[model samples]
Target: MFRPLELFIGLRYTRAKRRNHFISFISLVSMAGIALGVMALIVVISVMNGFDNELRTRILGMVSHATIAGVGESVRDWPEVIKKAEANPRVLGAAPYTEREAMLQGQRVAGALVRGILPEQEPKVSEVGKKMVAGELHDLVAGGFGIVLGKELAYKLGVDVGEKIVVYAPEIRATPVGAVPRLKSFTVVGIFEIGMEEFDSGLAIVHLADAQRLYQTDGPDGVRLKLDDMFKALGVARELAGDLGGLYRVRDWMQGHQNFFRAIAMEKRVMFMILSLIVAVAAFNLVSTLVMLVTDKQADIAILRTLGATPGSIMGVFMVQGVFVGVIGILIGVVSGVIMALNLEAVVKWIEHTFGVAFLSPDVYYISDLPSDMHWSDVGLIALLGFVFSLLATIYPAWRAARTEPAAALRYE
Candidate 1:
């Protein structure tokens, strides 16, 4: 293959330091800009992914994935529903449940969702059975007019295990005293902590049989189903409900966290777009550097033109040099970012412990520690976008170099 003189000179111009120190400074800025953009994108995206994973694992551990209840008010045969749900392949655990919105009357009165559950089946479904802070599962198993309260709720109501609390609710009852507002008293058997404010402040648990008699229901109010995959809660719930027909109405946990997941997804997209602008600015910086180089190397370009070099080959040479700069910077940033992302949690923990300072507070946010999860698709996309922008940045300057007039440029020289 015949070598073009213009191509040789373009390569030489890229390597040679320009007289304009500002252009060299601009080139360095461009490299730094791209590196920062790539690194930020990877770190931010990974943290978002980590947050998502945490929600599925930590939050889902306490909540039922899906539930099946009667369409009108409550299901009469919740036990049968539990049996049917347990037969499903994807169902890991099934338990009868009853939930009622009631006011707990005590020193500090608070509204709460009182859920009734069977002690033996509780372990198969909710991790509450294992997260007992002040009591045992056996205490919940022995049938009695006893209940368990969340640690925070117990604190708010100034109650403890073995203490009595009254739950007030409105129910239609035919009694000698004629029912108006009904109240029930039960001894607290245990307290649990699941590391979430909502659960602690708003939830209470009791025995299934005792609660069924309190609510005057023939059976459980609903069947809480825990699935092998929480992500499939909606699909599995719909399919399971259709199988049961009009006997029950199905509900999934997706409804409870829809707004939450949506907000995270939206924020991820917006942040990615905003950060990409930094990469765009870096590519434009490449344009400025190459533009200045063309102006300085006018005489060299003219000499190459006079020696028979094509404009296309001149464009190729500048593109190659610009891509080289971009590729080197991107590779460095990607490697560094990935290593940091993989180890971010441990590093943040170490910093906090060493300095007695917390990077993030569980009280202020959903989590207490920094987290990251690498997604290779994001990496590939970043590299490809950087390459395209770099190639684009080469265009105007390379065209200017190719258009140099041999006669006019060499006239003074």
Candidate 2:
């Protein structure tokens, strides 16, 4: 099939050697810059998306999507509340929970947030049961005075299953000499790992009755609610609270941690905008290249005008040429970027292993490895942006070329 005159001429111009080799080099540089920018954006955005997803799953596995509590400290009738909360279509499960801060003394000392859970009910609302590495959650009998420690927490305390550890509560006990912190010793019966360093290092679980006795409460503090769609936590919580009435109040995961996720979102947006500038700069660099090309092709443009080529056709030629360059760069970038995003975790691990370095640590970041997840929508957006900028860059120079006077151009000849 025959190609359009504009396309054929445009492609030919791209291949034909110009008087100045530097112009050709600049064109090559522009294309490379666009490709590099697109690749970087794809990798960075994918990593951010991966982190967001990992964090949500790990956190929701330990923390509830929503909670129902009383205006006072403890919910007197959590059993009824749990039943009512689970009645909502969006609510999948509900379980009573109590949480308190305490210090553990073993071979080493560490602060811990102790959670109260019913082994049978917990699996319905959280992933704690499934996340256990050793021992069963059901081993925590109501009056057994046993505790389940997170893997990192146990490591910090330097204790293992069946070992004894002293937990000092904030509550005070009257003594002959003076009031002292209430302390009790419990045996570690199980260990769990959720892959979230924060939770792993600072959280522990015990029987609901054990927790209530330790906190000196007759009932749990709240009822944790599991939802089909966690994003709808706020709405579902509100509806559940309305339906329950009385001293019942609702709290969602987003309400407690919106700032953290918001910061991530803001950073992602800022990164996208910043990386886009690199593409914009590359796209606009075509302007200078096209301008020089028009100057060099003055005679050819004049001849074409005399041959009945319209000004629009002249513009089309340059636009097509610039778009061709942009399209190739974007395509190359997309392929490289997708490859990088797909294997970023393995690459990071390899680099770390070879260099004897660690990119993320459980002691600092909440995770121990880098992750990446690519989305085609992001690739499409970046490609569209680069193409638009490249097409726009051709306009001014093409207009200048179309306005050339055949008489003036031929006068010198």
Q: What is the lDDT of residue 412 in candidate 1?
A: 93
Identify the leading candidate in terms of TM-score: 2
lDDT of 1 by residue, 1-413 (tens): 43664456555655787788888788788887788778877888889888877766666777789988777767776667777788889999898888887788666788888888888888787898777898865575535878788888999998989888898765765688776666788888899887677887788888877777677767777888889888899999988987897568888987988898898889988988888787788877899888887787778767767777677766776776677667766777688778878998988888898999877887676578877888999888877777787778888888887787889999998
For model 2, the run of ten residues with the poorest summed lDDT:
361-370
Runs of candidate 1 with Cα error greater than 4 angstroms are: 1-22, 172-179, 354-356, 362-366
What is the alpha-carbon RMSD of candidate 2 to the true structure? Answer: 2.6
Question: What is candidate 2's TM-score against the reference?
Answer: 0.90
lDDT of each: 0.79, 0.88
Candidates' TM-scores? 0.89, 0.90
Model 2 clashing residue pairs (backbone): none
* lDDT per residue as tens, model 2, 155-182: 9999999999998988998899999998
| C-alpha RMSD by candidate, in order | 2.8, 2.6
Residue 412, candidate 1: how far off, in angstroms? 3.0
In model 2, the number of clashes is: 0
